[model samples]
Every structure is written in structure tokens, then in C-alpha cells.
Target chain A: MFAGLSAFPLTPLRNDEVDEVAYAGLIERLVAAGVDSITALGSTGAYPYLTTDERRRVARVALEHAGSVPVVVGVGALRTSQVIGLARDAADAGASGVLLAPMSYQPLTDDDVFGLYEDVAAAVPLPVIVYDNPGTTHFEFSDALYARIAQLPNIASIKIPGVPAEPDAARARVEQIRSAVSDRVTIGISGDASAARGLNAGCDTWYSVIGGTLPEAALAICRAARSGDAAAAMAESDRLQPLWDLFAEHGGSFRVIAAIAELGGLVTPNSLPLPVRGLDRTARDRVARVVRELGLIPPA
Target chain B: MFAGLSAFPLTPLRNDEVDEVAYAGLIERLVAAGVDSITALGSTGAYPYLTTDERRRVARVALEHAGSVPVVVGVGALRTSQVIGLARDAADAGASGVLLAPMSYQPLTDDDVFGLYEDVAAAVPLPVIVYDNPGTTHFEFSDALYARIAQLPNIASIKIPGVPAEPDAARARVEQIRSAVSDRVTIGISGDASAARGLNAGCDTWYSVIGGTLPEAALAICRAARSGDAAAAMAESDRLQPLWDLFAEHGGSFRVIAAIAELGGLVTPNSLPLPVRGLDRTARDRVARVVRELGLIPPA
Candidate 1:
């Protein structure tokens, strides 16, 4: 179920509202490029900013566009009840699975952590994928906790943040996790810039944020990686690295999504929530130059 | 509106439900102890874990118990709609003001940051205090951004996290922000342990997490400080340093909250979220010893 590329699409907002037409176009482009599965309302999708109604609308639009492709909905909320409610909504909306993060408020104890997963898993009939993005949630699931959570039948996979620049250390940690949960769950590496090392670490699924912005390029890399073509995967990663770096240089995940949305001409007057600054003229020029060099789009 | 010790009381949970009885008792204690104000549903109160109904119930309880004491309710949410709705609820529930953190999702742009305050301020008639707890949000509102947001009429105060020991640079940053917005906004320092330094640096309010667990001791220290009794304030702080150290020694804010909650006998089986391991026995013993030494609680 988790063998190929999963594109976590960025939600398109136009003038403070969800632009369904642009969202459908983004989804259609990803599906055409051979994305195996799609995730909506993830970090890139600005899931937190979305109201319950907006989340349902986006999920429905994504599902309509996916048609046959499996669509996983991001269902993280600070409260377990809200998350469970969203999970039910996602399932009702015809989602194949839900990407759940631990409760983001209080730091959860191991028991609390496991309980959170159990609550969500029990609340929905669809399979669940644990998303460990400490960068946003400020909580990282340890290997032991993951191992324990993996024993739950409903948890189908995990999306681990891609390893840092140190490939070997990242590979080792992934290997340890793989060894512990190999029988129970699939492992997907996020942070597309380091997807190559993740594959080397034995991860089979690649969750791509870039895929949301550049579906063809993202799919090509995933396809190359799946076929055991390390060189091509690395080449694709190298080409995409500039965009990733641009996101990092600006700030982190949200800025990157906003930048991508601006680039796609899908959202205008794009903005992030408080505390995150937007791309400046310098950052915009850098992204434009990279896009031009990569032949992804015409120069701005 | 901005002076003395402010207590961010814990939201009591009984049988996995909101314990309004216990919460009201806690608020009564803070108010009786001469706490300048009480903040309901802050991070210390586990606001993020509470359902909207639970949050409203707790806010109601705090307001009822507060009587004439000003109760500032925390109203930050990942979604703008949720925040607006919560702010309205808080105002309707009779909270004196709303303490808001920038939306916690991806980092926010200056426009997004200002927009959040402007929208929240406009949505509720009550005064608003801009909360800047970067430790949890992983995003810092720049002095420039804070300056702009502070210009809004309802934006009455700023809660900056206390200076970390390292990056001695934060002291200067705090001063710079104070310089820009001090006239328009009163600055509140978050960490009780850092209150002495923060006060010296021009912070007018000491918003206390530790105060929730040790109301009398915290108030004594605040009163001492307000009256220019630095020696007494330092002495009380010295007594509390080990507990603060326990928080710093482990996971910053998460560990501190969990430790204090355990000590106060508020929540049994207290635990933090993932990535943050709970205090080990050794750390727990140290905290216990400090609590005892400071006469923070009676001997068992």
C-alpha cells in the first residue's frame, strides 16, 4: 500500500478562501504524473489554518481529482476528540487513510502518546499512518514508541522526517526503526531533499512536498528510486535540492509551501500564520533562478 | 492591567474529563493569594488538550471563581476561525482579556502575524495580550513584527519568554523590543526563574507557570520584587531554582509543566508529549528535594 510516491498537496487559498478549481487542477496534475497516493491538509497544505468545513471541502476536492488514487488525509489536532472527529470526517469523505500526529499541546508521556494513537486508530476503520514531524509538532516519536505503536493493526505506515545531511546516521536510525517494525508497517521518508538516503536506509515510500509543486519531477525521482536507480534518484534530488534549500533558507515547511503556491500562480497574496515571515525579494529571485535553471518553469 | 504576579492555572481533569470543581478551587486559591491576575487555559492549563466545550467550561469556571480578579484567557489556535471563535467565547465568558500566540502551524509572515492580531483584536472587544512563547511555537515574532502588531488598540501587552542562559543575546533582543513597543504595550516575562532579570530588563508583568503550583511562594516573590525587595525575591527564586533547573535539565517547557503538575498533586500519572522524555527518577528526586527544601509543600 505504501510502495510509491505520495504527494502531500499544498492547499490553494485565493483571497482568504479555498480555491477549489486551482486545488483540483493541482491534484489532476499530480495524478497524471503517476503519483501513487496523495495526502491533503498536511503541513504543506496548511492543515492547521483550515477550518473543519474547509478541511472537508479540500479533502472532497482532492478525492474527486484522485478518482482511483489512494488519498490519505492529514488529521492532526491538539485535542484527541477533534482529531478523532476529523478522522471520522476524512473516512466519511472517502479517504483511504489518515496521517495522525500526536497531540501537539502538552508533551505526552509514552502512555499518553500510545493512547493518542490508539484513540485515533480505534475511531476510524481506515488504516492510519503515524506522522513524526518534530519540526512542527515539537514532539518526535522514539523508535521504542514507534515499535509499540506499530503493533496496532490499524497503523499501516510511518512518515519519518528525512535524515539530516549526515546520511549514515540517518540511515542507521531508519534501519533500526525498520528492523523493529518491518513486519508490521511500511516506512516512508519525508523531506524530499534526502529521499535518496532514506531509500538506501530501506524505506520504500517517499512522501514528497515537492510533488505538490512539481509533480512530474517528483514522480520521476520516486520512479527512479523505486526501480533501484540510485544515480537517477540522486540526480533528481540534486535538481530539487535548490528548492528545498530555498524553503529552508527562508524558514521551514510553511514558507516553502507559500513559495510553491506563489510559483504555481494558484494562490495570490499568499500568507502564513503569525511568527513566520514570508519570502523576501531576494528569496523570490533565488527561487526563480533555481526554477529557471531546473527548467521547471519560465523565469518570473 | 499589567503588573504583579499572574497565575496561569492548571485545567484540572477528572476521569479524563474537565474537572470544573478542582479548577475553580485552584482559581479561588490564586485570587485569594493576591495574584494580580489569573490566565485560564494557557499552556500550563493544558488548553491545547481541551475540547472547545471543555475550554469554554474551564473559562466559565475561572471567571466565576475570579469574581473581580482579571482573568485573561489564552485564545490561540492553529486555525484563524477557531481562534476567533474562541476569543469571542472567552469575551462572552467574561474574561478580562485574551492572551494570544501567533497561529501555531508553519512560521508566519509579518503580514500574517499582524493580520492575526488585527483580526483577533477586531473580533473581540476585550483587550488582547500578544503571547510570544517561541519555545512551543518554534517561531519567534520579530521585534519589527511585534512593533506593528502592538500598534493595534486592543493589543495591550506582550508576553516574551524569559531569557535563556545561553544566547545572552536575548537580553538585548528583549530590550530592543521593549524600546520599540514599550509605550504601547506592557511586556510580561514568562519564566518565573528569569523574572528578576526580565524585570530589570523592563518587563512589567511576571506570568508564572511555577506560580500555578506554588501560588503563595510565587506571590511573595512578586510582592517582594514589586516593592523593590530584590534580596527577598532572589531568595525565593533561589529556593525555586532547582525546580527551574529540573525543567532546563530535561525538556525545557514540557518537563517543567509535567514536573510542577506532579508536585501539585493536580494530575496523577502526569506525562509529556513525544520526543520529550519524562523526568527520570534521579531528576524527579532532585525536584522533590528542592520542593521540600524550599518548604514549597509539607513533608510527607
Candidate 2:
């Protein structure tokens, strides 16, 4: 289920609406790069921003462009019913699975958290990947809680965001859960900065932000890591280190998708939802410089 | 703007759907208790968990029950577009204003944060109240950025969650912003525990989760505070101290909502979103005891 690199592409927007044509082009590029799966309507895709119809349109365009590639759609929402509806829409749009984040609102009890997943899992027929990004949810999944969720029939994987400060602690937590759940649940590592470490810790999948913009390089790294070619994987990772550094330098995960979109020429002066300021000239130039160094853009 | 107590009533659910009848009843209680305003679809109302239709229905029901009392609707969403849609719906539903939380993503840049508020402020015709609950969003609004956002037309107020580790720092920042922006943006403090502290910090409004269930007592506390009856406010606050303690004992915001719902007879056997472990019997009993102490339930 997790052999090749999967890309979560950013959803392009125009006039405060989904830009389907641009989104199709981005999806085609990733599929052409031999990506194993493509995720749409993810945080990268600004899933929450899109209208229900707009989200469906994006999903339709993405699935169409992806052709035979597995399309995983993000189905996170504040309400369980909305999530269920999104899950249905994703499945109808021909998605292979859905990734779910914890319901937002601080300090959700373990029961409420579990109930949300159960409601979504039961509502959608597709396999569901539980996304545990405590950074966004402000509530981390305890190992004991994750283990209980892993036992659910339709839950296929867990997406854990990599922690730069204590990579080992995160890795150990993932490994512990993986062992507890055994083959029933696969672990997917988010945060390309710690992909190598996560993979070494038995993460079955790696969802790369950089990969969405540069699938070839991301895939190569994944292939190397999978084949136990540590040197090759590290080298590829190092080559892309500048881009990762750019993501870190420009406010980490928050701006990474927009930065990638700017580099890929998918959108002009990429924007985020209100209250998110745009990157300055200096920040944009830094990204451009790294993109050129990585041969992401032709040297000029 | 910041002179009175505002209550966010629980949006009751029945069999996995919005229970509009119960919702109206809840709002009626709050209105009867002399609450200055009612906030619908706020985090306590489980705004994120309800479907759009459910949210609309609840808002309509609440507005109807609230009569001419100003109704502020929470329109926070991960996407700017969605927030705009919600703002439109809230306006149509007769809400007097909108309460918006920042986007739910990790490591949001200052630009993203600013963009979120700006977009929402621009989208809704009604005045917008920025909800700055970093405890849930994991993205705090910096003083510099909040100052800029406060300057946006239609940006009327800010709802600062009471649980920040450094409430004084937030207060200082708000004061600084207010000095720069004039009274264009009023400040509202969330969390019943810190309502008095927020008032002392020069906040314009006090919002209460406990008020969802204990409207009479909550409004009494607010009236006392607003009338400069510090002694009475403190006495009323002390009487409701058990309610605040339930929040402390249950360990988070959502739990407090669930506990209060049970005490109010608005819901039976309270539940929360999944992955969150349910409150244990001991915890539930603790909550029940507090409810009894508050005279929220008839003496056995």
C-alpha cells in the first residue's frame, strides 16, 4: 500500500475560486513522474477553503488527470457530518481512500476524538488514513489511543508529522504503535525534513510536500530508501535540503505549499486564506534561488 | 462592545444530527437570563462538527429564540472561501456579527494569519470579530499582525481564549494594538475561569462556555461585572466556581461543553468527537457532583 512516493499537490485558485485547469496540469505532472498515489483537497490543497462543489470539481479534475493512479482525498472538517459527506464525495469522485485529521477545538477528550474517526470510518466505504498532526489539531494522539483506532477495520494507516526537535521520540512513538498494531496499520511520515529517519523507523509511507512540486527527485529518494540504499537516499535528500530549508526559513509547514506553488509556476503570487500574509520579496527570492539550485527551474 | 457577557449556547444533537428544537430551548434559557448576546456555531456549539445545513438550521433557531438580542455567529473555517460562505449564511440567518477563528493549520506564517482575518473581514458585510484561540489553532496572532488586522474595515472585535499560558502577554499585546488601532477593534475574552481577569485587562467583552448551560448565573456574573459590582461579580463567580472546576477536572474545552450539556439537561450521556477517550465514570461523577454543588440539578 505504500511502495512509491505519494504527492499532495496544492489546489490552484483564481478569483477566489478553484482553478480546475491549473489543478489538472499539476496532477498530470505528478502522475507523469510515476507517483504511486496523489492526494487532493489536502491541507496542501487548501481543502477547507474550497466550497463543496469546488472541492468536488477539483477532485474530479484530479482523478481524471491522475488516470489510473490511486487518488487519496483529504476529508477533514470540524463536523463529523461534513466529513462524512466529503468522504462520500471523494469516493464518488473515484478516490481510492481518504485522510482524516482530528476535529479542531482544543483539548478534545479521547472519546470525542475516537467518535469522530468512527463516524467517518463507518460512513465511507474507502480505506481511511488517520492523520495525526498535533501541530494543527493541538492534540497529539497517544499511543494507547492510536492502537485502539488501528484496530478499527477500515483504518489502513496513520500519518504522523515529523518533529524536528525530538525526531527520535516521534520515531519511537510511531514504531511502538506500528508494532502494537502490526500489519493492520501502516505508518506514513509527513514532514520531508525527517522522512529518512521516519522510513528507517519502519514508516511504510512518506508523504512529501517538496515531492508534490518535484516528484522525480522525491520518488528517487523514496526508491532509494525502500531499497535500503541509505547513501543514495541521503544524497537525494541533501540535494533537496535547500528547498526544505526554504520551507523552514519561510515559516515551516504553513508556507511550504505556497512556496512550492510559486516555484512550480503553477500559480502567480500564490495566496493563502485571509489573515495569512504573503511571502516578501526576500523570501520569494530565497525560494527562487533554491529552486534554481535544485534544477527545478532553468538556470538564467 | 466589551461591556457585557456573551453566551455561546450548545447546539444539541440527536441521533447524529442537529437537534434544532433542543437548540432553541437552550437559547431561550440564555436570553431569559439576560445574556447581552448569543454566539452560535462557536467551538462550544461544535461549529466544526455540524454540517452546513445543520449549522444554518441551528443559527436560524437560535436567532429566532434570541429575538432582538444580537447574535454573533462563529464563521471560522480552514478556508477563506468557506468562511465567506458561512458569513453569508450567518448574515441571512440574522446574526448581528461574525466570530472567526484563524485557519486550522500548523506553523501558520504571519502573512497566512493576517490573510485569514483580512479575507473574512472583507467577505462578510457585518462586523467581524477575530477569534484568537491559539490553544486550538496552534497559531497565535502576534501583536504586530493583530495591529494590522485591527485596522481592517469591518474588523470589529477580537475574541481571545482565556487559557493561554501567558494571558498577560496577550493582554499587553491587545492593549498595544488597541492604542494603535483606536477602538476599531474591541477585545473579548473566552473561558469562564479568566473572564474577570480579562475584564481587568481592559477587555470589552466576556464570553462563557458555562453560560451555554448556566445562563442565569452566567448573566448575573456579567451584570455584576458590568455594573462595577466587583464584590457581587466575585460572589457569583465563586458560586459558579464548581462549573469552572469541572473544566479543570475534565482537562479541556470540549469536555467542559459536554459536562455542561449534561448538567443543563440538553443532552443525555454526553459524547465527544472520536479518538478522544470518553470521560470515565469517576470523571463523569466528578462532573455530576459539581453540577449538584452548583444546584444545576435538583437535590436528590
Candidate 3:
């Protein structure tokens, strides 16, 4: 359950509330597509934007709908006490494991981050995934910090950001972190664009953003690598270059993924939380055209 | 009311709850010291660490105890709806203005950030202070973004981070921003170590961190600068170089300020939000030695 493709789904919203039905639909889609794991309340899920009650409900929905696929809930907060509380909630809701990001407002010291993982480890019995998404959390992890934290009990995995573009560089980077943590801790690659490259570099899992929405496409790439066909995996990823380009041009995957969900009718229009407007008409139209051209959406 | 020294007091906590009596005492002390205004939920106030209800209670306590001092509330949240809601609460509590930072979970685009201020401006009636605290919020506003936001109606002030150390460069930085906004928008400076320099460089206000706990020392530097005594202001700031050194050595002012508040009997021991630990015993003893030598604390 700790390895292979882990899909990160958006917890869609409607009228300023979590659209539980829509969110469960997202999870069921991932489960049906056969992702090895489903991570609810990921950065894609807008965990920080939600209230405690909303998070609890979202966790329960994911657990109920995910069926055999292991559910990993993101339990991150600014305060240590809050993170611990969220971790307990996740455990109570039957989460298989908890993904913990050292979410920060005060720029956290390495010690502060270590203290966070330490406290969570002491309090929660579930496996902990050390979430290292600096793009959102703004706290970069040192290999030393990863090494230190990976030694803690139940530190199940480390979700690293994108690998370097070049093949050798990506492998070396993965190996560097690999040398730091023990073999029991799986290495999962995020940064949807670099998924193929990271997998070929021997990463055990793709903690994928795109996997949540287009699981069939994501699994095509994931399965190719697992079958030892590295070239096929890269070829599959290249096929989705348009989507990766959109992610780069925009700030991140959240809005772009939301745009796709709306176009596919998987989620309602205006499904994003307030203050995050959808892509402007021109960019959105470009996405529709590209998805159709790529056969990701049926042409009219 | 947006100019001069605006003290940012910590909303002291005890046993994981807001210590309202202690919080009121901190506000009253700032009032007695005659700061130009009181910002109840600045980064110093641990605004992001608190809940909406805790923030509301703190705002009311600040208003009730501040007498006639203008109170500006920090209404920052990760989601746009949450920020606007906090702003509405601030307005309902009679805050003179609201300070807003682009609090982020997913890295925000410039457009995303602009839309946030736009939504808040349209939704809330209070004067808006554009809080540019990158150390905490992790979002940097380009000068163009600042100019763009300043054009919004009800945008009252811009709280810039700090000026360059060189006098000429500092003045140029201030002048660069001044040329963009109309005079109706005041320019406030944060970064406590640089406040005197910023004031000397003609910044209209000092949005201070240290001022929340040590008003007299901050006011000395601020008053000297306002009285056309730039040299004295520099000297006053220089006299507190030891404290500045401590701030420089530590991560930021939050822990050090918590230590000061605790040592001076303003709040209970370990009043900071959890996961954020106080300084080590050695560092704390050093702080105590410096304070006693500087007469910040009476001998004991």
C-alpha cells in the first residue's frame, strides 16, 4: 500500500461548502481506476482552506468510498497541537496512514520541523509520510532532516518534489535521499511533470497530482515503469506534455486540475473555493482544445 | 491614524487557550505608552495560529482596552472567504482598519493574489492595509503588484518589509514605492531592526514586531525620527543593537518576544502557540542578561 501510484484528489466545493457527493465521486473514480492509494486532503485538496469539521467529514467520505485502496489523509496545520489533533482525527476516521507537511506561517527552523514530526509520531499510531512539497509549505527539507525524521517510528515514506529533468541527475537525486532513509521507507515522487523520470530513477511510488483526475492516463505511465519499460513510461508522460505545460504556465496544478474537472463534468463549474478564480477564458479554451486533440476529452 | 508607531501585541496564550486578561494587559500597556495605533492580530499576534472565534475575542478585548487608540486587525487566512469573513468581523468589532496578507497553501499567482485583495475590498468596508510580510506569509509583492493593489478603493496603506542598509539605497527604495501610489495611501515599514532606518528614509509608519512587547524602546526610535532627529533615532536604534543581535541570531522575533513577555511577567511561561518552542536555556539566559544590562528588565 505504501508503494505504486498514489492519487491525490481535489476535495471539490459548492456554495462555500465541501460537496461531499462530488468529492466521494472523485475518490470512487480513483478507486475504480485502481490507484494503489488515495490521498485525501492533499495540497490539491485545499486542506488549509477547510475548517476542522469539514476536514473530518472529508476524511470520513474518502475512507468510506475508497474501499480496498488505502486512504492517506493529510494532517497538517500551523500549530503543533492542531496538527496532532488532526492526526488523531485521521486515525479515528480509519485512515491507513497520515501525510504530514510542516505547514508554516512562521518560517520554521529545522528543529521546529523535527519537533513537529516528533510530536505527531509520539501521538499518532499510524504510518507517517514526510510530505516535502516546498511549493505550498515553503519549508524545504534537507537530506539530513529527512534522514533524521525517517528514523522515527512509523515514518513510512517521503514524498519528494520534482526530480531534475536530466535522467542521471534525477537518479542521483533520488539515490541521495534513498541513502539517507532506511529501505522500509518508500520514496514517492510528486511533481506530476517529472513522474516518469522519477520512476525510472527507482522511486517506488508516484504521489501524483494528475493521477487523481486522469487515473487511467497516470496509471499508463506508472505501469510502464513498473513493468521495466522505462522508455515507454517517458513516452507516455510526453504524450501529456500539454497538461504539464499548463501546470508550468499557471502557478500550480490546483486551478488547472479544477478547470479539467469542470470541462469533464466530473465536478460542477465554479467548483473551486472562493478567491481562486478559474483560468481566464483564453487559457481555459486552450485546455479544452488540447484535451480534445489529445483524446483526453471526446471531440464534438 | 495609519502613520507613526503601530504596536503589534502578542495575543498571549495559556494551556492552549487565549489568555484574555493577559492580552488586555498587553494592549493597555501599549495604550499607556501612547503608540499611534494598535494592530491586534499582526504576525506578532500569531494571527494564523488562532481560530476565527479566538481572533474575534482578541479584537474585542483590544478595542475595549485600547481606549482611543486606533486598532487595526490582521484578517489573513488561506482562503478568500475566510479572510473576508474575518474582515467583516473586524469591521463589526469597530476596527479602524484591517491588515491582510496573502496567506497561501498552494503557491498563489500574482493574479490570484490581486483577486484576493479585490474580493476582500469589495466585501469588507474597512480600510485595508496590504501586509507585505514575506517572512511569515511567504509571498513577495512585486512593486508592480503593490501599485496595482494600491489603486483599489479602500486600500489605505502598504506595509513594506524593510529598506536597504545603505542610506541612499534605502531612500531610493522608499521613493520608488512612493512614486507609484497616491499620497492617500501611507507607506508603513516592518522589520523591526530596520524601522529606524526606514523612518529616517521617510517611510510614514512603522509596523513593528518588538513594539508589541517593548513599546518604550520602539517609541524612542520612532519619536526621534518623527521629530526630525534622524541621528538620534539611529542612535536609539543602535543602543538596542544587542536585542537586534539576538533577533538576528534567532530565527525571528516571535520566540524571542515570547521569552521577553514571559520574563517580564506580561504572560504565563510558554505562552507561544505549540510546535513553536521558546529559546534554549542558554539563549534565554543571554536574553535576560542583555535585558538587565539594557535596563529592559529591573535587576532580579
Higher DockQ: candidate 2 or 3? 3
Give the alpha carbon lDDT tens digit for every residue of B120-222 in model 1: 8887898899888876666677778888888888888988887654324645766788788848678888866687666545567888886676778878777
Ranking by TM-score: 3, 2, 1
Structural similarity to truth (TM-score) of each candidate: 0.85, 0.89, 0.96
- Model 3 per-residue lDDT tens digits across residues A100-153: 999988878888899899989999999999999898888899999999999999
lDDT of 1 by residue, A1-300 (tens): 577888888786665678888789878877877788999988888787777788889999998999798999999887666788899999999999999877465445676678788878877898899998877777878899989999986999999987756657867877888888847689999977787778766687888787776777777787777788877877878877777777677657567566656775755545443334457777777776787787776122
Model 1 spans > 4 angstroms off? A108-112, A164-176, A262-289, A298-300, B109-115, B122-125, B141-149, B163-178, B196-202, B249-300
Task: State the DockQ, from 0 to 1, for candidate 3.
Answer: 0.67
lDDT tens digits by residue: candidate 3, B1-300: 999999999988999999999999998899989999999999999999998999999999999999999999999998888998899999999999999999877767788899999999999988999999888777889999999999999999999999999989999999999999877999999989999999999999999988888999899999999899999999988899999899888878888888888889999888988778778899899999998888886111
Candidate scoring better on DockQ of 1 and 2: 2
The number of residue pairs in model 3 that clash at the backbone is: 0
Instruction: Count residue pairs with overlapping backbones in model 2.
Output: 40
Pairs in steric clash, model 1:
A107-B272, A107-B273, A108-B272, A108-B273, A109-B272, A273-B108, A275-B108, A276-B107, A276-B108, A276-B109
- lDDT over C-alpha atoms for residue A293 of model 1: 82
lDDT at residue B239 of model 2 (Cα atoms)? 76
Q: Clashing residue pairs, candidate 3?
A: none
Which has the greatest lDDT? 3
Docking tier of model 2: it is medium
Better of 2 and 3 by TM-score: 3
- Greater DockQ among 1 and 3 belongs to 3
